[model samples]
Target: MPAADWWRSAVIYQVYPRSFLDSNGDGVGDLPGITAKLDYIASLGVDIVWISPFFTSPMKDFGYDVADYCDVDPLFGTLADFDALVARAHALGLKIMIDQVLSHSADNHPWFVESRASRDNPKSDWYVWAAQQADGTPPNNWLSVFGGSAWQWDARRGQYYLHNFLTSQPDLNFHQPAVQQAHLDNLRFWLERGVDGFRLDACNFHFHDRELRNNPPAALRDSTMVSSVNPYGMQAHIHDKTQPENVAFLRRIRVLLDEYQAIAIGEIGADDSLAVMGEYTTGGDKLHMAYSFNLLTSEFSAAHIRTQVEQFEARVADGWASWSVGNHDSVRVMTRWGGATPSPELAKVVLAMQLALKGTPCLYQGDELALTEADLPFEALQDPYGITFWPEFKGRDGCRTPMPWQGASAHAGFSSATPWLPVPPEHAARAVDQQAAADSPLSFARNILAWRRGVAQLGQGDIVFFDAPEPVLAFRRDLAGAPSLLAAFNLGGAALQFDWPQAAGATPLDGHGLPGAAEGAGVSLPAYGGWFALV
Candidate 1:
């Protein structure tokens, strides 16, 4: 692969900084913790390590609400710690990608502080501020993704400021040229720090309609269709996000990335995410790759996966996609897709399916261990979203628990001090040390990733779905002048048999570590099983 195209078929591992490891015994993971584990990350055969935000913050929304865009938080470490991390990761042949939360900043951010100070301030226009209606209501029908109205009354400015997420995270006014320039300058600061790329958080929320038109009511309220916990999805979201000006801003971001030979993958959350993803990346002057919430939902059927991938392929002809099944914000794939009790067989199948697809794959930390979502009592829950919703929604704390590195050690070797979130007892037995055994899922995951790297057809090939019965997801991956590979999986809980005519001349590829049996006539997959063949 060309240097500029390294991300095209890359397998990127997402390291949620706070849960990865703790080096300072502060009960929270930090930059030095990540640096200490660089070799382990590289051993997974991933090309990039996408570290979640560690910037200075009030921790209201963790590091997403950045108080200082250009500095590392003292909680994580200082600037020197970050530089050491970059140096160590590069030494191990791993590219470092940091999260850039450009959509909003912590209310304590100097820009937000000054902008909210007074209407006449020079930075007053840097944030999205609007006046209330005669009735004292918000200017429009915009709703926050967290809960309630998106507008918050700022007494200092005597106006309502927009916050797409938490009220403490005030939205930036990208409509203002100065705001856009300042954000670009922030990116330039990181580029000068030798970062390889950026994971653009909430990339679509950069611009809202200047008119602040009322969003029309949504026609449906399906959880699978939109976020289930919050009513933010109850509106059409037409005016509040996915604005046309976002494309031009992405072009500006792309130009800056090009100057440093870096790459960017955008996180797009929208009502029509596929369409927005196509628009954001189709021109190549926008995001290098973009991923939506299509695969992060509760749906686990083969048909759903096929539709998401096919729709993206159709809509974004020239665009690219980066696929993920689990992240910091969602429940673990094992508990969501698999049963309450995590199954190693099911985990293997899911990993195979994600890697076999025709896009860049992202592996969340602890996913290789087949870790299930930690079951925490209400008092143990620290996520504000869950605390607010309580029983109806558990929030993201289940997925953000500390990683288990040693099964027998206290706190699972995550920290000497008490961990911010207790490590689940179920995950302790599946720690890195235990999973290093030959037959463990962690070993299987490493083998699968290494095998994927060797097969150019699997990594960079075009994907074509086969006409298989329900519960059976069969696809053929083909590249010009390379041997095509046939990959199939049983996503359901029952045994399945399928006659794949296209695999007539194919031979089973060993060392894939997937369960099931393959024969000359056809292949039989057990519950949550997979089969791969080189044709």
Candidate 2:
């Protein structure tokens, strides 16, 4: 029970800074732009605002590759602008959590430059570097998440450096204490700026197998393991990432955050994310919470969601879980789960299901208003990983498109000028102004978050699913003396009739215009609708 522990009941609104809003005439989002939109985001009832990396970078991997861990990118704005953003967000009672890419640094980063300059230089040990193979190939067969070899030939020292992601992102040698301390110092810089916490990127890749041993052949090393389209997960990734040493690093990070009264939420991107989430957040001393692509992928069945939440609860006993059906990395959930065109009803049902679960619900940039994947022409794609495996893999650009604020404004009012990625034309109809016309999708999202403020069982209660008929996913979230709530969802096209569990009392709140409705104890879910109760 600490101040930082407040994130347990918090609603984290993830802002893809580049696509958020642009105050300058540059078309790209900046810190001042986010500051301007503080009222809009706070109105959504989100307690925390988790900004994707706005750190200085070459932007090869957008802002994921950090060139300067402690500084803001010029394109995004200056450090002063960031401070102003933090101040404004705090003034609105919104906690600010910035993205920290500790696993790797931009290849152009000063640290990497120094580390690869000389084999025996003071900084040579900062990054992972090993000798070349006999035929001049990379030392091992480890492949980059962006494709090709994970080892990049650093001509500066006649040694190959490691990068599990893009070649421009060189993996840091966490084996070095100095490297670990340096990264911790970067965290301190933000903490000193009154930043609340961090969403650690690739949190499991902090350590590599120390021996530089080649990863053993993986079982079913096929497309099934990869993240949808990107070929990053073909290998078992045993040696390349998720090393046992990462737990210690996480503990170290937790210790650092603990000192400043901050919390850490890790992005555990692995095929076995459940197990990793179990490991990365083993105790209260590690990550406060961790999220994965388990729910983010296109899988939308009630059974699938039940299994995922149950598996984590059974396996990750001591850890907190975070769920997001949509993010910048994958196609929007509306298109991924809902058939053909976007289904706002299904989207609301999915969001309700997420909020009903016993965990923090993180909303992606545009998921609230039922945003679908924008069609980004290959010519306009900026993600190198997507470009490398083009046509079949369209990259994450579609999901990272600009947020539409106004229905008719140029660039959807996301910017005064042309935006970095064009706003989808279809997005105009679902714009904030359009949806906020009355108590609509946008309003429901706000209602759910606000309603969450009074419900403790909905956030951290022990969940027990009732044996309801197919398509009607019903469950009870119990927190001892607190009233156990019944959550029923209709995932099918036809209305689902469910016999709700006998709880103390039930009150229906379907006026929000979302999916699902409740009529006393017997409720009928209107095709892809849901109902949440305070029993």
Candidate 3:
């Protein structure tokens, strides 16, 4: 009955294993590479490290299409390598969390291979399979997120199988108790191996309506936000995912975590994100916390930020939220909100805002130094998702380029061999070694993160908003036991001096990483300038 201590004010750093660092000469990151970089990660003041999928995989959807849940991929290393990495991370006081794709698996997986053999196979019901329509089309009108039919015809089974993303990745039949138990066993494998918890990939998509009912079309007026951005938001998606029965499955996983005092953080990537985030984290028996893409997009105004936080607070009393402006998915924050040309100072403002919000903050790799989305040419593209969309969409390869380790070293010292994705020209200039030598962009990030940990107001406090104009965001962090803090930021590229309410008895607080002339009130932002202080 105690408060959730795992993530209350913790900072989580995400490591996309393939791009973090390369130890061997294969041009890909391995467990040893990650182990070597733990100090760099821990030095950023992050309390947890959530690594993306590195389990046995075919690497079709990168690592999202998992082949085996319990085994480590050779590309990454062996079980002993992983165990060593976990120990090294814990030595740095970092809790390790691995991504578990329980929703589906690669067709090459033995379970999937057996399930697709024939109708009479013992594993036939393990995946979502159904007879084709009279017209020889898919069973339902459900569209895949990757843009097309959700069903693939399996000639051997003589029945179409469901795939919400790629055709090779079939949807797991959560209705089967054995499937649920198998996923739980996979969780146990990691828990016993010293992993702290899991970052459940597409958590709400684990269940579906058994009747194969069509989702009700979202009300045109109600669906405006989603309809404008992507095609996946066109439908209500009620039946295809976020089923009411998902609660029972969540409880099953939560119960397992409870046994070992572990925690689970679910990624609620739903069309109605706020509502889905509420449901997934509502009760104590459900997920410990959940995150969505509400702020990961290009929305940057004060109104948009306020509406997102306020709406979630109104929905549930016991739920916890995780906020992130930049992540592995979507465009980088610098490019997404600040456009192709971003205000360097504005990046600090956004970080300040995230630190002030009432939730755990996830920092994507290279975000602290305010790394922008690297431009990659068509020939060098590696991500199929981005390649298929072509000129319309350039894929995630830009944001996923290799992490630059040194400013002048070949390939930024990530590997002696070529990397899976080429390092960007601009990224090499912001390398870790360069940042370590002097006051560089990467060092700025480390200082900010380290200073945030020392500030009580930023760690735990009630957020109070002040009346401000369009791009100016003003708020106060008030705590009864801790000193009150006043914070302000300029969202625009211009500078304008303005007077704040004088009744707050606020005094100047030292500005750590921001410029000297930008901290005080009657001050204006020089493009992304932000300041926080104890009053």
User: Who wins the TM-score comparison?
Assistant: 1
lDDT of each structure? Answer: 0.90, 0.83, 0.81
Inter-residue clash pairs, candidate 3: 345-528, 346-528, 386-395
Error of 1 at 193 (Å): 0.9
- Badly placed stretches (over 4 Å) of model 2 are 1-4, 221-231, 499-522
Q: Sort the candidates on lDDT, descending order.
A: 1, 2, 3
Candidate 3: lDDT over CA atoms? Answer: 0.81
List, residue by residue over 1-535, the lDDT tens digit for candidate 3: 1345647678888999999999998999888999999998998888889999999999999889999999999999999999999999988899998999988899899999999988888888999998898999888878677667778999998999989888989999999999999999999999999998899998988888898887666665222222243466677787888888788999999999988888888887676788888888887888888888888766789878877877887887878888878777767888888888775555666776787777788889887766789888999988777776777778788888888988799898889998999988787887777666434556666777788777766666667777777687777777787778877777777765556653244565664666423323454445566656566
Per-residue lDDT tens digits of candidate 2, residues 416-496? 888899998988778898896455678788887777777777766888877777777888888877777777888777876
**Model 1 ranges with Cα > 4 A deviation:** 222-226
* Candidate 1 structure quality by residue, lDDT tens digits, 301-341: 89999999989988877788998999999999999998787
User: Ten consecutive residues with minimal summed lDDT in candidate 1?
Assistant: 221-230
RMSD of each: 1.2, 2.0, 2.5
Compare the candidates by lDDT and give the number of the best one.
1
